[model samples]
Target: MDRLKYLLSPIKIRNMELANRVVMPPMGTGLGNDDATVSEALLAYIRRQAKSGAGLVVSEITAVHPSGSVSPTHLGAYDDRFIPGLRKYAGAVHEAGGKAAMQLHHGGRESFFLLMQGEAIGPSAIPSVVYRQPPREMTLKEIHEIIDSFGRAARRAREAGFDAVEVHGAHGYLLTQFLSALSNQRQDEYGGSFDNRARFVIEVLEAVRKSVGNDFPISLRLSAEECIKGGYTVEDIQTILPRLVNAGADIIHASLGTHGTPAGITSAPAEYEPGFNVWRAKKIKEVISVPVITVGRFTDPALADEVIARGEADMVAFGRQQLADPDYLIKAKEGRTNDIRICIACNQGCIERLMLEPGSSVRCAINPETGQELIYPRTLASTRRKVWVIGGGPAGLTAAYEAARIGHTVSLFEKEEKAGGQIFYASKAPYKEVYDAWIQWLIFQVQAIGVEVKTHTLVTETMLDEEQPEAVILATGAEKIIPPIPGIDLPLVCDAFQILGDEVKPLRNVVIIGGGMIGMETADFLIDKGCAVTVVELLPRSPVKKFASHGYMLHKRLRDGGGRLLLGTEVVAIREDSVVVVSEERGEEVLPAEQVVIAVGTRPRNELKEALSERNIRHFVVGDASGPRRIIEATEEGARAAWDI
Candidate 1:
């Protein structure tokens, strides 16, 4: 607690005094009503976040106009009619004992929904690198109208009882498009020079200040640097930071990257080091008198404290960390650091779900109650039951822990000598040590809550009948699918599971069948081990291409490391020193391989399901026992099944 003095200290920004330096930065949740009004679900989520003890909870991005909307459910502050709901939003945070701020944003060319409707607008007629849709350049008259819209929105925020307002000028939005030379090519007043590029946001800040009054605090969120070639750097933007601050910005929320920036830098996968952008914030703070808020891959409070103690920034924003554990700051304040459920930055449930799945709200892969504040179980069970959870994978561990948490007598059994099931092997892959920490956390939770765990013990029907457990949760996990190829039984052949589990050491040359996530990951793992690898997939394209951020990163790394990915190809047979493959372009080919690894996929391993059903046992099947899926599904199913029990 003493070491976290800087992080736990109080700070004052304008008239609002924050209890601590922690800030829950704005994170978009597609939980608003279709008409762009606040919903009960969104309110519940915000209330829960506020209860986390953050000094300030910046609400999700709210559009200033319809043309700036990213989705039909994007929260709006364009009209006065939204004030009542916005007031409720502020009340939710205030009542929970936290300050509230509304993030005002315009998506510009990044507004996919607006582009689909042919109504996208930006400072210049430039297409966003991610969206690839050219936006209609705003006329001088239209620019003033949007600036006025921002002012009106700020006034509405103040009227709605918000402590402050944040002008979102980063991440390749309308303001960023104007500021960046890569996006803005206009020859008019809003372009051609640094002052011209900075004109729109500064004028908007002035408008917002005039609307909100002199005493109100306004935070300007900016990408410390564009983080891409041909884009503005922090040094180039330092000259404008002071000018914007002079225009009425009270605080600078310094972040990194734009829409086209790699995930390794922006949203940062597990491979990225924590506090990667603190230097950028330090740079911004050097030229500005206002306090700076740095945000980027900050999960550990100790790291945040170090950043503040070093004066890199006055505050730190833990975005995804708040989603994973709403009580993050509270737990840290209590010195229960190990008890905190740290975010692994996998981007599965939050970013991927938000972008790839329409109508889905923000969620955490590790925490099932993230967006389910209104529905997820909280109270203890009315009648404590004797629950037996089979298997020791993520699903079983979570089920055991959650059941114990809900005041049930839970016993978990694992057939293997050690627990962690698939996650045990997954952690062995390159750049996935985070999974190891996750499994350890799950196991620690189960053990800490007094859940009885028995390893090297496979639950049988006879044992269940003898014990007479009231309920059973079968999370037996899955088994790797072995294709019935001609020479699959050769001595040089094995499944990816064996390789990942360290049961098999492949030779210098290796061939992997499948081009899915696991297959690509295995190739990457082998490539790291100095193995010449080739991946073959029967599908026309990689499944990972659907969300190419992490996939492309993996693909690029694999190709750069000399790994071959053969799409639309099938494996025919395995030979002593070679494997036969067939593709559309090439009828048949033989590839030399010292070893062959199968990574097609997995199937549910529910052998006990029929046996338990025959005995009329009250049981629920969860996780891979139902179907092979991602860790998100497994943890969610586990928690839900435990609640049901």
Candidate 2:
């Protein structure tokens, strides 16, 4: 096998010389202290990524001004008071032999709860879809103040020992709003024409450059296209790129999408291929002389190498991929790609964390030690112990792997012949190939650590007694919850798991009784196979409404894919060839179908948990067996349990 090395090669930017090309892009972990200062928790979080061998660690999006903050817990570079904590953060990164950069941002109209306190400000007094708040148009005086704020923030970042400062000009933030024609409809010198719209960003770059001086690295994150209707396109960027470069941008970090609509910002359900946004980078690279960094679903190391080697991009940024495994670059450099935990792109953890649980830290579905570095340190105990993990699902696999890594004699048991558990069914859906990578990588990690994995074996008290392990972890997982609707026991009625597992044959017409993530994804797979599909959900909106902004984008794609969506509807009965549904607005409706798939919910598998309790043995229950939830919760719980052992 050819050893890939360029990803680990040294790269110089301005006066900062990086140890490698693996740059950790700015991500919002939401771990800031109450006073908007960088917390010890945040320091430990970045330290883990630095220790994992990233060349450059970009701090999470730090607000340049207080009103510019996306959330209350977000890090702020607005005041000099924050410098001491930030200095400590920079020292930690430097201690790990990794350079640090700070990403400066302004939330603009995207401000959530803060909008209620003060007027949301943007280039134009337009309302955002997500925030639904009308923003006050920024006056010339306010614009100048904000630009100065950015400069002051950059000066503070430099004083705090950051090697570089990246201006967050992408993702439809304040700077992006000034650059986008769709948002910036003002006829002043700051809006309307491309040059006018690009004026503010140029000023920001020039201000940052003047503040940080000629030797310091000043990177600008540019959105090649807004990816929305009437938004700036690649052609629009051609006129602005040179201006930004001339304004002293050391590097152009290119990305796409806006926060208003779901389009272009994320991979729609209809398009789930890997490296979906590389072409945007390639097009931007064609016009810019500055080194361009691009990231959007670039998971495969080979593909990352190809992008850099072919000159499509100077740096490949791994977002969710690096979240699942911070050591992604280290493992790739060592030819251990198979052992690297792959992000399944299940927004259940990343996106959902911010949307559903606001102010909580972001986490990964596969990697459990994400933002909980303080609570669960990566270092293992000095004494080795014997650990037994029962079940082969995500939680069980994670627990076993963590235990084995800490010099534990680990044994994992699964009743099924193969691993993955319920995730096996999840991967069978269309556009879920990323899940396969996660499963394979996790399995490889367990085996590589010399953990004994026994398939086709049911764990019981007898086996537990025979093993006499120091610690036992129960990750028995979950089972599909089938509602007791009339005629649900009919042979034509099946659950989503059965269909996904290939245990049930696809029908000519299918009626999915729930409009959640699983049901919608199943509908997508069935519709692609030429099966007419109808989704019935009892909630006012689809269950996917609980997903993150990006996940909602995917939900919209599924809705636009020609499938019948029956929201605020409940399934009352299931017939051999039809389903009876009831909705408040529609009264009663009969949906004709050859098969009915129940995807309402799932229940924890607690039979093994009961057995463990009866034995009075020292054990911990994690994953689905503890409760039915997303993979992120399961992985975190499992890793914590193993770490305790």
Candidate 3:
């Protein structure tokens, strides 16, 4: 009678009873204190997700050893001193009517040498791709000490009120380093052959089980495929799965691909489908009786339910989805799926921030309240008023919807027929249609809140003067900045907007003037279109250097697709069949191309500033119109502006 209600069904793992099959997988948010013990921030974040009505919430990686800590803010369970804070975390989850688990972690060779305060140690000497450390081989004594640490961590987890304890065996952590043949090159019992390679994990599991006893539930996270050359695959997991289960693992939480492997930094990249790793979980499910928790971009509740309905996975772990919308399960159970914010898998805020930025706290691009759980909107304004939001981009849409939700009569005006001004073209890249989903949600929320959206209507100062709104939010966004080089206006030359929109059809050989995110994304699109794309930039390094993860993956894809990049080059002029450029390395040069695309950057379109000033209207500005920035800042400012009005 109901469509896909199985996602709200109950489940059990050993001694722990979950309210539903929905599990919030462990995703580090840098919420803990400097000592890596639980802080109020971590408690608040866990409480928010637990309040979402998930069946289970697995707190982010809890370091079992000092060297295992990823950052100063990573959660810790290595000693009894950390038990009190962790107890509070588990208690809050219990108060929210959800089961909680603690994932014991040890980075092994993947450890940050600088943060570890010593040389990283693994099963064998291997170079760390993430921390750039030359790790030494671990001795038998060190191996036993780490095993004892995991055992102690599990004991602490049980004492701290956790319903279950999960071993962070995946993600190229200590256990994985010993499991993967590429990383494990030791001659000891902890390395070499398949059985030997798995010995370390088995020992840790045995120690943990010996400490927690048979009554406590135990889970192990495993990577079904390493996605790296000469690395393990699903067959490896098929064999490794039984070893873990036999070693007292009551549940198998199957995650996909290892970090620092060829798969890149994110477990769920933007290119992956909603249940990309469900097939892997299914493979494990076929061989083992233990419940398998499948995790990989399972954002859509319908898709999540299908995984269980078809018997693909026993549980669905929503990591980024829960971060984007803490009320995801609650909304779905209430038959209000439309109210749930889609994750969209834009790594800009979550994983990208975690991997690239040092000491960065995890935040959501769509949901600004992710890490700020303690500071919530108290109440919507009781006094209603007229509100005008200019431009229907993310900022304007957010302001309009938020204002209306605050009991304001709001109107949003867009010059284009559709909303998502810049995002419209930005989403044209491969597998980027997810942005459209976010835009759709924004449109739905604004319409549901009764915000009058006047699209294809350009509002001027005269219109604002006549309406005389109590508040005006200017989100006009920005415009592409065309360099003042000679022949810049040539028909053969166009900006990334035109190229992405297919307005200016790219020629066989194309040379772009910029190497920023917009430029690189456009270049990637052109390279896929069988065009020879060459990006020439004025900077010596990547212009989008701040976007470490995005820049790394994007540039790699472009280069792999036969794209050429010329950094430290300045465009002098755009000719009929070639573009003249100058670089420090190569003083003067002619880059022959049929099309010269300009993607240097954008300049703020604040023309409405003087217009509103003349009208003498009460106004505020946000988003690109204020200054070109990311979606998070724009949306946050929009919501803040609405509350201020």
Query: Best-fitting candidate, measured by TM-score?
Result: 1
Best by lDDT: 1
Model 3: per-residue Cα lDDT at residue 230 = 87
What lDDT does the true structure give each of the candidates? 0.89, 0.81, 0.84
Q: Residue 175's C-alpha lDDT in candidate 3? A: 88
Candidate 1 lDDT, 1-645, residue by residue in tens: 386899989999889999989999999988899999999999999988889888888989998877788998999999999999999999999998889999999998898888978899998888887788899999999899999999999999999999999999998899999999988888999999988999999999999999999889999999888888888999988989879999989989998789888653667777777898899998898888799999988999989999999999999999899999998888888889999998988887887788778788888889988887778778999999999999999899989998999999999999999889899877877778988998998888899999999999989888987998888999999999999999999999998989988899877999999888788888888999999999999998887673445676778878889999898999999999899999999889999999999999999999999978887878889998899988888888998999988
RMSD of each: 1.5, 2.5, 2.6
* Ordering by lDDT: 1, 3, 2
TM-score of each: 0.97, 0.93, 0.93
lDDT value, candidate 2, whole model: 0.81
Candidate 2 lDDT, 574-640, residue by residue in tens: 8878999999999998888889998998888868666667777668999888988877778888888
Looking at model 1, residue 154 earns an lDDT score of 97
Give lDDT for model 1.
Answer: 0.89
Writing each residue's lDDT as its tens digit, candidate 3 over 1-645 gives 465577788887778888888888988887789988888887887877788888888888999987676677888888899999999999988999999999999988776733356667788787656666667788899999999999999999999999999998888888889998888988878788877898989999999999999988889988777777788988877876677888989989988666666435345667777887788899999889988899988887888898899999888999889988988877876778988898977776788777777688888888767887776555778778888999998889988987888688999999998988888887888877888878888888898889999999898877877778877999999899988999897878888999998787878999988998789889988988889999998889887653354466678888888998899988888898899999999999998888988898998887888888777777888988899987877887887788788
lDDT of candidate 2 at residue 62, scale 0 to 100: 90
Name the regions of candidate 1 deviating beyond 4 angstroms: 546-548
- Candidate 2 residue-wise lDDT at 213: 96
Of 1 and 2, the candidate ranking higher by lDDT: 1
Q: Which stretches of candidate 3 lie over 4 Å from their true place?
A: 113-116, 263-266, 382-385, 457-459, 463-468, 544-553, 610-619
